[model samples]
Target: MKEYKYTINGTKYEVAVGDIEENIVTVTVNGEEYKVEMEKEAEPEKKKPVLGKPAAAAASTSDEPATNKAAVNKNNAVKAPLPGVITDIKVAVGDEVQVGDTIVVLEAMKMANNLQAEKAGKVTAVCVKIGESVMEDDALVVIE
Candidate 1:
């Protein structure tokens, strides 16, 4: 049950909304109860979670060996935001980087996207290079 207060013209009413059977709702005002029929059926509200995505790097598996680079990574990993080919790699292992620094450039949807760092850290590994194609959330760089 939900409680609400409404004012109509110069009159105030305290309402407690209760269970509904079809289009009618059980409501009480003060000490009186009433069954109100809704002209239009009510619909329940729905909500969904939203998440932010980052840019992706473009690359071809032939250009960079994914197996060798990502063989081991630190706790924090920078992932590709979208599926695309790795067009350019901006950082290498052992390089210190700051937030907003372009870690790689991914060519997705025929557009070149610069994938930036979300936090300041050292690049622990480089997972992909130029001409390599990567999928969404693919490991691009591991940061520590």
Candidate 2:
């Protein structure tokens, strides 16, 4: 028997291959039986090798003022309160929204929570899309 590890959404499981015939594969994971289908392996991603000096250091030294301005502008960003998957996005960019408007619906712990806007402003950006998982204090939107 050959053992393999499978990871899905950060959860890992150890599986043992049992029998293979035609396109069907029978396997066991943690004492549970599963039948799977064989699929072709995807091609490896080609990496571009960097030969010159790092661009980050040069960009930082040249754009210090612009970077500071951008940081100051992001002070009004709206963030998520908890770790959850964004189930819905209610408002779009350029939409004028008032305080307490439902900006997004987050699903956490098997419950749907309505994330409301804290202040009146036009939505400058909606950061997360539907079915995207976010962590606590992660930026969800930028209202300006």
Candidate 3:
């Protein structure tokens, strides 16, 4: 059972909800008890669509030869830590960055996160733009 107090038009009312079984519920208001029948089940709120590379694609890359992976990663590509949309790019091509410098602002799970540089280098490529979505491990920038 749950209790709630509400004030409307300067009048205070106490409500208690008890025994909700399917569409029917036992409810009490003030000092009166009644059985209430819900008109219909409440629809759940819609969720935002998740856009990015699927897990299978990310897993398949691990099966490639180590040499090929190392060659591609030699440029110091700064990858996304998680799936998110690029809210802002703090650096651009040719920009110099030191370790721990903020490189990009990513929005994930309704929070903005500052993605920092892992190593000092000059930016050679900006792989994603503001509003572009990226998956975990997707390169957002490349430095050399």
Top-lDDT candidate index: 3
Q: Which is the better candidate, 1 or 3, if ranked by TM-score?
A: 1
Q: CA lDDT, every prediction?
A: 0.77, 0.75, 0.79
Cα error, residue 71 of model 3, in Å, equals: 13
Model 1 Cα lDDT, one tens digit per residue, 16-134: 99989888999999758999998884578773321111223223424455565647563577888899977777898899999999998888997889989999988877876666678
Candidate 3 error regions (>4 Å) = 1-75
- Model 2 has an lDDT value of 0.75
Q: For each predicted model, how many residue pairs clash, with residues at least 3 apart or on different chains?
A: 14, 0, 0
**Deviation of model 3 at 115, angstroms:** 0.4
True-structure RMSD, every candidate: 11.4, 14.7, 9.0
Write down the worst ten-residue block by lDDT for model 1.
49-58
Task: State the lDDT of candidate 2 residue by residue for 1-144, as single tens digits.
Answer: 899998989988899998988778999997799999998567799844322225323534655434443554455767888899777778877899999999988888878899888999998766666666789987777788
| Predicted structure 1: lDDT | 0.77
